[model samples]
Target: MRAFIAAICLFLLCGNAVANSVQDSTTPADAIVKALYDNLSAAYLCRDIVDADKYLKTRSVVEATMLAFTNKQDASETILKKWEDEIQINLKYQNQNISVEECNTLLRARTHQLYVAMDTLFK
Candidate 1:
């Protein structure tokens, strides 16, 4: 009876640990997505071509970064920080090269791509 109780306790603890670890791993991606979504929404609302371009570019960079992190599970914090910093620097110098219509089209495509990328992650 004592052995049975100990085994049950161990099973529960292991299960909980697995659940926590999975949640912990996903949290960073979730955060990055939320931040990107907010920025994109703001750009769309403000009708800012520069912001729209920045959003599209940042989205691609972040997706690539995440993919690289997944492929190499040992991605260091410095690498992730560098990627984030690069996005910030790029956004700071956004140019209004495209017209409003072009910006809209690009942002629309980027939003759909973001959804697809996030779906794959969640799966």
Candidate 2:
């Protein structure tokens, strides 16, 4: 359990650090960007209640994700806000706390589970 949590936290940190890259929608890197939004949504959902240390940690992750998209730096704030808003809005009906399996499933998408995991783990 500890390792899983640590892995996911590391995943988010890695994802937060890897937002930039290949620009085409058809490219693999696009999936990583989409994955980043999913994470930012999760972080945004928890930021309201998590402790300052955790919040700040997650905030840095979010910031790094933004920095990864080098070309998208123009209007970066708006883009980040829009992505967070769109993804977070979809969570309006979800439970405040998510189970590990559920989160993994929603994020991994069956065949893409490995892809997402590897992307998050080493992006």
Candidate 3:
């Protein structure tokens, strides 16, 4: 009877640990996506082209920034600062008000723009 109890306790503990680890592992991706969106939104709102440029890690983002800021080189610093500030605010509001649908829409628009630019640039 004692051995049975010990085995059950070990099983439960292990299962809990696995569940916790899985939850932890999935959090970073969400965090990354949130940060990306927050950065993009700040850039869009502030018209801070430079900061917007910084957040474009992918080709799509770069293309989007180029398209959006084609004539606004003077506001680069302001935009970058705005992006940083937005990131700080997002950290404070982490897991609040993030909309995956919005993120998808923004990403798709940026990517499509990027592809168009690539075609033009290559041509």
Candidate 4:
């Protein structure tokens, strides 16, 4: 009976450790950007230009600024906010001069930026 209890305890402990390890290994930033990209792409594919434009413009500016700046918490926050504001302004003018292809190009650039940022930050 004692051996059975000990074995059960060991199994639970090992399982918990494994779960925690997996959680720790997951990169939150990468996951966030990837999900954002996927959803944005889906929106564009569905011809939801408004939603796609919003996501792509906001993410593109933020990710680009983040990738360009040195890794610092304060700088990241500041640049991200600035980028967001810029994106909002740009979005207002989107209908006047923007095209689907341009949005796609910006999104691709942002994706590249995200990858570079993750590489630099994680490494």
Arranged by TM-score, best first = 2, 1, 4, 3
Pick by TM-score: 1 or 2, better one: 2
The alpha-carbon deviation from the true structure for residue 29 of candidate 2, after best TM-score superposition, in angstroms, is: 1.1
Q: Which candidate gets the maximum TM-score versus the true structure?
A: 2
Per residue, candidate 1 scores C-alpha lDDT tens digits across 1-123 of 455334433332232212012343243344334434333443434346545566556545544644443443333233434444544454432544667776667656655655655555546
- Please rank every candidate by lDDT, starting with the best: 2, 1, 4, 3
In model 2, pairs of residues that clash are 20-68
Highest-scoring model, lDDT:
2
lDDT of each: 0.44, 0.47, 0.39, 0.43
Which of 2 and 3 is the better model by TM-score?
Answer: 2
- Residue-wise C-alpha lDDT for candidate 4, range 1-123, written one tens digit per residue: 455334433332232211012242234343333433333333333234445556656555544534443344564455445434443454333344556776566556646645664564456
Better of 2 and 3 by lDDT: 2
| Model 1 TM-score, all chains together | 0.33
Better of 1 and 3 by TM-score: 1
In angstroms, what RMSD does candidate 3 have relative to the true structure?
A: 20.3
Go through the candidates in order and give the clash count of each: 0, 1, 1, 0
Per-prediction CA RMSD (Å)? 14.5, 11.3, 20.3, 16.6
> lDDT tens digits, residues 42-85, model 2?
55455444433543564456456555543244444555666655
Q: Please state the error at residue 78 of candidate 3 in Å.
A: 15
